[model samples]
Target: MIELPTLYHLATPDAWDAEASDDYTVSTLGRSLAEEGFIHLSLARQVSGVAEAFYAGRDVILLALDPHRLSARVEFEQVPGVDDAFPHLYGPIPRAAILSATPVPFAQDGAHDFTGLLPEPL
Candidate 1:
């Protein structure tokens, strides 16, 4: 199988901090792993769109995850009404899997400015 690239998860500061265990249980902005059945993830190119659509005008932290470090299985699945397949984690995210967390800055127009947030080749 082809190796997955770095996966990104958008999370609020409070929610990201609340996960004090070895594994993170929160699935998305307002959902949980148990409730959603998986953690929603994005590719480097999808970060800006996901943020604008779901987290506009909100303070969020961008979590860069290393797929190899995660205990959960990451699957690329298609969602209705979306053209591209997104990465979904089948289990809780392990703390070890998190590569870095950076605060997402918003532009004056209330849009998320993801400038330089992603690594090279994005």
Candidate 2:
């Protein structure tokens, strides 16, 4: 068997909770899988920046996803201005694929403080 890298998704507590079935359909904070066409995922090193950029001043849950458990296709696509390619899941995330759902802490300045929240070498 091949080992797949763990991917991350920053979601609101409400959004994550809404997915009560086997498949999670929410794409991002405000978008749905049907609307966005794909779920945005980040690498460990990109989690902090993504949280700061899109989810600043908000409390979020960090979902650790095991790609090997997912049935959807995970594609790494390069955005127009982004330096690194980002992983996008073409289908809804199955409940089994979520390894962990941890609450993210925030700093005094209303920014997400991802210290100690991510894996090592991040």
Candidate 1 per-residue C-alpha lDDT over 1-122 given as tens digits, one digit per residue, 9 for 90 to 100: 66778999999988878447658888888899999999999999888889988888889999999999888788899988989999999998888888888999888788987888996662
The alpha-carbon root-mean-square deviation between model 2 and the true structure, to one decimal in Å, is: 1.6
lDDT of 1: 0.88
Task: Give lDDT for model 2.
Answer: 0.88
What's the TM for model 2?
0.91
Residue 108, candidate 2: how far off, in angstroms? Answer: 3.0
Whole-model Cα lDDT per candidate? 0.88, 0.88
Tell me the tens digit of each residue's lDDT in model 2 across 1-122. 87768999999988888447658888888999999999999999889889878898888999999999889899999977889999999999999899888999878777887787788882
| Backbone collisions counted per model | 0, 0
